[model samples]
Target: MNPPQNPPQDPPQDAQLQADTVWLESIRRRIRSPSQRNPDMSWENNAADLIERQLQYDGHRTWGFVIYRTTYASDADWAEFLRRLRFQMEDMFDYFNGRDILEKFALTVFEDRSLFDGASTDTIRQHFQQWSSTAYRTEQQQQQLEEGSGSGGSAGRVSIGRSPRYRFAVQVDAEALHSVVHDAPAPPELDTTKKGWVKLIDKSWYLGRSEGKSDPLEPIKGVAEEDVGWMKVPYQNVMTEYYTKCRSPNNWSLNYRRPPKVAGSPFD
Candidate 1:
């Protein structure tokens, strides 16, 4: 009888650990490197300038105290808000930069008073001070923020709610602008066309775009009030697969400016 063969063994413990460490480092580098994800990021405008420009816009000056609603618990809510505001600020930069409207447009963030306990310009500036003082604003600049808010007469008041949200005080060519595009339809398959359906294929739900004849049993559009089953999939997962299949890359030609009164206002 032939000798029995042994299965291949994994590397020794130390070797295996080192291999894992190296693999993790590689992933970290890839995530940190903007060029890996956004090819045009090298030429993109820095985020700090974007925030300042947006704050300086005229709309904020005229529309004092634009209140926004939030869902964050009061515990360290300011910190959470700041972190998200930074991300939104980055998005604003990417959107405007892609549209070639860097100078002609601006976007600003306002603190919701419901969360901040009637935070005035000074209160909001103080929060920014804790995290972004040296980077974005100085103590002197707090006064400036007050001047801008007071002069414009537009401060963001806060509201408490289950749905956490923020406001983008958008300005175009020194005018208080909401969005350039108003009520633009969502994904056609999701709204107008009976083309997409949330169907289980291979044990996973998808916002799939149907072909030829539509799936009558699984309609694509939203049903009146309740959350749609397959549409309930996490946004990130849906976008990941959707973008891979239908990658609409941003370029100089894309317009990211949104219309005013895009959603019901808390101020209203």
Candidate 2:
């Protein structure tokens, strides 16, 4: 008898869907296929997988990662950098447009040891020592970490600084761009006409400034009214653009003014 004819081979150009659970729980039973099979599939499978997993596990969320680079020549430059950094931190949690996250994890600053040829990890740690000791591990700061306001463990620690090339990692718990929470806060009342004691209803707007306390207005550092327009910007930003005409080498002037309050309507 002729040798059993081999099963008709799939043409090299034809796509085959092999059953795969290589990413099970990530995607239910999914068909495994070569990228060439669906060259026309326009969607990003990886991103779609992430969205699916986030909704299933993390409960529909979008996260923001803030990263920037700077080279500091002196302590003055470092001080200015910190000033702007603190302002951005406050704005991220306090402003209306900033009320995006459900959580914030940590911020880390790392020195680019690669900038220095043959720089060892020990040398980098030593270079970063001054900042680490002064900022992250003070008695009150440690206490705050214990109390849950600051990042608590080693994960919350800022490792490197005092270097020419510095990179920042600001983590936030902001919503995904496509989430549909039933109780998302309303956009800030853009009607600048009326003014009075408007109670802050959006609890997400405050980071920790008013936590556990019932303050009628959120206790946030105020930015100038004109500066409110800058709220939506975070990633890929030029810090100096916002710092212009604003004092530096001193504190970034965040004169915390409460958002314009509107009188509650009687008809409600």
Could you tell me how far off, in angstroms, the CA of residue 200 lies in candidate 1 after the best superposition? 32
* Candidate 2 residue lDDT tens string, 66-175: 22222323445334444444454345334222232323223444435354233322233344444434543342235435556554443244332221112112211112
- Cα shift from native, residue 154, model 1 (Å): 27
> Mind giving the per-residue lDDT tens digits that candidate 1 earns over 1-268?
9999999998999999999889866665655323322333322232323223333442222111112222233434334333433343345445434323233222234345464543322333334334332322232234446766867853343221110011111111111111111121222112122111111111111233333333334332432212121121111112112212211233101212111211111211
Alpha-carbon error at 16 in model 2, in Å? 69
Candidate 2 has an lDDT of 0.28
Score candidate 1 by TM-score against the native.
Answer: 0.22
Instruction: Evaluate all candidate structures by whole-model CA lDDT and list the values in order.
Output: 0.28, 0.28
Top TM-score hit: 1
